[model samples]
Target chain A: MARYATTPSQTVGPYLHIGLPWPDGPFAVAEGTPEGVWIRGVLYDGAGAPVPDGLIETWQADPEGRFDHPDDPRGAVARPGFRAFGRCPTDANGEYGIFTLKPGPVPGPGGTLQAPHIDVSVFARGMLHRTVTRVYFPEEAAANAADPVLSSVPEPERATLVARPAEDGYRFDIRLQGEDETVFFDV
Target chain B: MSTDPTTRPAPPAYARDAEVHPPLDYPGYRSTALRHPKRGLRLLPHLLTEVTGPLLGEDRISENDSDLTRQHDGEPQGQRIIVHGQVRDGDGRPVPHTLVEIWQANAGGRYRHTGDNWPCPLDPNFSGVGRTLTDDQGRYRFTTIRPGAYPWRNHDNAWRPAHIHFSLFGRAFTQRLVTQMYFPGDPLFFQDPMWNSIPDEKARERLVARFDYANTAPEWALAYEWDIVLRGREATVFEDEVDED
Candidate 1:
C-alpha cells in the first residue's frame, strides 16, 4: 500500500509586524544615503521555534564601506538610486527579510578596515534585553578571518555569524538561546 | 512643462462599472480555528501615553541598584545613552498608550545578569531595565546612562561601542518591534555588527538620534526623545485559509 504525506498549515505560527519609527519624518531622503542592499533572515528560539513577533533591526555600510551622509567623514562616493536604510518587522512565522546591497569594509578603531558585516539587534517580548548579533557573508572568508570581531570568537563558533549564500542572496539564521547559539554581545 | 491639447482623456463611465465590486452576503471566507477577538484591548492605553512622562530630573537614582563589584561579572554598568522613540503607522500617526522596555550593557560593556563574563565592573545603581508609556502625542522617553564599549573574543583588537537595546509593544502583538539605538559620535558605530546591519543610509541615521542641545540638561543629566507607532484597528486585515499546500 502507498501512503501520502500530510503537510501542516503555514498560517498556524507566529508572525512579525515591523515598520520604521523615525522622529524626523518618513525615512525618505533623496540624496546623501547609501545604496540599497538586501538584508533578509529568519529568527528562531533555542528550541528552533520561529519567533513570530520578534523584531529585528539591521544597519550596515554602503558597498564602498563608506557612509553616504555629509557627517560621514570617510569622504563622498556617489551611488545614485541607492538607499541604504530600511526597517521591517518579521511576519508571524518569525521570518524577516529586507532588500539592500552588501556593505564594504569600514574603518574600525586604530584605522583598521573592519570586514564587511551587518550589525543586528533582536527584540522579542519575553526577552529581558535586546540581543545583539552580526551577519557575515561566506564569500568574504579571508576578510572574515581578519575581522577583529570574528577573530574574537572561537573558530567553531565563527561559522554561526557567517551567512551562507542562497539562490536569491544570503541566508543567516539567529538563535536566541541553547546550543549552537550565535554569540550575542552585551552592547 | 507645456500644456498640450493631445493629452489623453478620462475613460468613459461604462468602463469604470466593470471594475467595481458588488456587495456580497459574505465578503470573504473565515476560519473557525483561528477566530478570536483582537488582543489590543489591554495594550491600547499603554501605547497612547508612552511619550508623555515627566522628563527624568537630575539626581535620579540609577536604573540599576545592586551592591556588587568586580570585573567580568556581566553586571550592567558604565556610561550609556538610551534613545527612546515613538512608533507611528503608515500614515505617520502615533498610536498612544504602549509599553517600551529597554535593556543593555553597563559602561564596562557587560549586561546586567547574563552568563557572559566580560571583564567590566557592574554598577550597583544601574539594573539596566527601563519602562515608559507614550503620551497623547505618541511619544516615549527613557532615562538611561550611556553603555560602555567592551571587548569580545571575536577579534584580538575589537571592542563594541556603547549602545542601548529597545523593545516596544504597540496596541497589539501585531504592532510590536525590537531594535537598538546608537550614539551619534561613537567611533565604534561603524565597526559594530549590530549598527551596520541596517542596510539603508537614511534609515540608519534614524536609529541615531541627533544630539539636541536644548534637551540637554545640566552637566549631570542627558535626555533623548524617541517616538514609536503601531498599526491601528481599521488598517488591520485578516485572511482566512487552512493551508495552501
Candidate 2:
C-alpha cells in the first residue's frame, strides 16, 4: 500500500541580536525650564496591566500653533515660555507624563484651527506592530467637540481620547485593546 | 480504546538507507549560554552598546542627571510631553516579541542621569529610562514629562532643539534602526547640530510626526503617533563551512 510521510521540522535558530543601545537611561533632549500645560498618563495592555519599560514620544506646535524650528518658514515667533516637543518613557508601573504649554490654535491643512492636542506614538516588545493614540484635554470640550479629528470618530468613543483633569494637571489612560480602548488612528 | 484491525503502524521511510548512513543524533549540540537563567536578559546590555554607538558623537549630558534620583524640587515647572508609536514589519504587518528602549532629557532640558551636571533639578518621580516589549499587534507607548531644549558644545552659543531619541530592533541586526523624532514647531530645527546631521531630506522627514488633533486631549494632555517598519522574510544562504586545515 502507498503511504505519505511528513518531513522532519527544521529547527529555528536565534535571529541576529538586535537590542537598544543605552537600554537603561533617560532620553536626550534640550534642557529648559518647562512651561505650558501638561498631560500625564499610563499605558496598559489588553488585560489592563501596566506595561513597564515602554517608550512614548510626542511632537506638537507651540502655544500659538507655531513651530519652534527654523526649517518652518513661518519664522520663529516669540511665544514666551512655549516649548513645542517632548519625550519620555513609562515607569516601572507603565506610567508616563509630559509637561508643555497649552498649544494655540494652528491653521490645519485645510486652513482651520485644529483642536489643541498632542500627537503620540507608542513602542514596546511583543507587539508585531505599534499602536498610535492621541490625548485631548477635558477643558477644551468646545474646541474638541468641533475638532475635525474628533468629529471623525463616533460619539460614543470620543471620550476615550480626552484627558480628564487630575490634581497635578491632566491625566489620560491608553489601553492597547479591550473595553474603554483609547481612540487610535491610522496615520 | 480498541484499535481497528485495518489500521497498522507505518514503516520507516528511510529504513532501506539506514545501513549506509549510521543513525545520527544531535547530541552535544547545545550551547552553554542557554543553561544560565540570566543569560537571556543579559543580552540587552550588549545589544544596547552596538545600537547606540553611532549616535554617541552628539551625546551631551543633561543638567538634570545628577538629581534624577532625588525628590522633585519646586524650582521651575517643566513642560509635559508624550511619545507613542507602532512597530510594523516591512509589509506594515505588526511584529510582536520585540524590545524597545528610550532615553531623553527631562522637562528642564536635562536628563535624569548621564554623568552631566546642569543646573536643573531632577524630578524624583521621573527616571528618564524606560523599556517595553511590543504586544501581539506590534504596538508600544510611553508617557513622560516634556523634555526642554538645552544648550550644547556642538556650536558656539548653540542649543539643541527639543527632540526624542528613538532606538528600535526588528527581529535581527539587519533590521535594527536608530533615529530621533522632532517636534513640528521647534525653531531650533534649523540651528540644531544633530537634525542637520542627517543628509537625506526624505529620510529626515521620517523623524517628524504629523499633528493629529484627534489624538490630542485637553490642555493637561497631548498625543502623537508614529509607526516603524522592519524588513522580513528573507532566505539564509551559507556559502560553505570553514575548513580546519
Candidate 3:
C-alpha cells in the first residue's frame, strides 16, 4: 500500500478562540435567509461534561449540490449567495451555532447520492487531532434511508448521525464519550 | 478493538506511543464505541465541489485586529516580540492569502477567558487573541507578548509550556489546520505531555519557533519565526502556469 506522510493534528488547546473565530466566521449565510436554519449544538467531553471552549466547523454543498470551486470535476458552479462553509466557536455554555442553508445531496463513491448532510470537524483542548463526523438532516428521512454513507453506520447507532429537529433549526449534541457517544468517523 | 487510524497510515510524525494520544482513546480520550473509528469514515469525502473562499484582505484591516501584544490601553507585559513565518503546503510552497489566527495566555500564565480562574493577574492591555491573512508570499506576522507557562490538572503539578495557538484556513475546506508553536529553550518540554505527544522527535522540535536576529529590529521588538506545513496540496502549481495562454 502506498502512503503519504501528512502533518499530524494537535490539540486546539485552551486558547483555541485566539486563532479560530473571526468577526463574521460563524455564518455560512445570513441568518433568516429563506430556508436557512440554525444548526446549533453543545459539545461534551467523555465524563459527559460540556467542553466550553471547543471549535466546530462545518462544510456543505449548495441547494443544487453544486460547488463553487474548480476541483468539482463537474465545474466551479456556485449557487448565488451560498457560502457553503462556516465556523462556530463554542461559548462558555458549550454551545456552537451556525446559520446555513440545508445542504443538497452530493455524490457517494459509486454513483449513489449521499443524504443532505454536512461535514463536521471538532477541535478542543484535550484532543490532539480533530475528530470528523457527519450531521444528517432528520427531515430527509426518505433520502437518508437510501444514502450509501448512512447505511454503512450500524443500524442501531445510525440515529446518532441525524440531528434532532429543534424550534429554530436542528440540535445535535456531540458526545466525546460515555453513553450515546456521537459517532465519530476516521477520516 | 484497535484504536489506530486505519484509513491513512499513521503519519511518520505521530507520537511513538500507541495510546499516548489521549483524544483518540475514548474514556481516556472518551470511552465509547462511538468514539472508536468505524468503517463509515472510509466512504466520506472531505472535498466538496464548491468549498473555495474568496479573498480576505480586500477590505480595510484595522491595526487592533492583528496585533495582540498591546490591547486597549496598557501594553501586555513580557518580552515584546514579533512572530512571523510562511504557511506552506507539504511541498514547501507558500500558501498565500490564507487566514491565520492566534491566541495565547498573557505573560503571567493567565488567560483572559472566564473558564480560567487561576488567580493570575490579567494584563490590562492584552486580550491575547489576534489574526491576519498571509501575505502574497504566504507569510504572516504578528506582534504579541510571549505567553507564560500555566498550570493544568492533567497530572500532579502539570504546567503547560508557554506557547501560542495557531489556526489556519485555506480556500478549500479540507485545507484547514490548528497547531501550536512553542518558544525555543523552554525547560518544560520533557514534562509537558502535549509536547511529548508528537512521537517524532523532529516533529516535536518543529513546533518551536526560532530566534531570528536579522528580522528583529535594532531597537524595537525581538523576532521569532515558525513556519507551518499543511498536507496534500502542491503549493508550487502556480509557478509553472503560463498567463499568456
Q: By TM-score, who's the top model here?
A: 3
- Chain B TM-scores across candidates: 0.58, 0.60, 0.77
TM-score of every candidate:
0.40, 0.41, 0.82
Candidate 1 chain A: 10-residue stretch with minimal lDDT: A1-10
Candidate 2 segments whose C-alpha is farther than 4 A from its true place: A1-35, A70-73, A76-83, B1-245
Most lDDT-accurate candidate? 3
Residue B160, candidate 3: how far off, in angstroms? 1.2
What is residue B115's positional error in candidate 2, in angstroms? 23
- Which residues of candidate 1, in runs, are more than 4 Å off? A1-37, A69-71, A75-80, B1-245
Q: Write the per-residue lDDT of candidate 1 for residues B96-156, one digit (tens) a residue.
A: 6555555666666666554447677767766555655566766766656677777754344
Q: What is the lDDT, from 0 to 100, of the residue A185 in candidate 3?
A: 67
Which lDDT tens digits does candidate 2 get at residues B1-245? 21521122111111111111111122122221121111011111111111111112112223333232232454324654455677775444675756665566767777654444668776656655555666778887665556677875545677767666555655432244445556777888787534444444454455676555676657854666766655432222332344333
- Give the interface RMSD of candidate 1: 23.7
| Candidate 1 backbone clash number | 91
- TM-score pick, better of 1 and 3: 3
Provide C-alpha RMSD values for all models, in order: 25.3, 24.6, 7.4
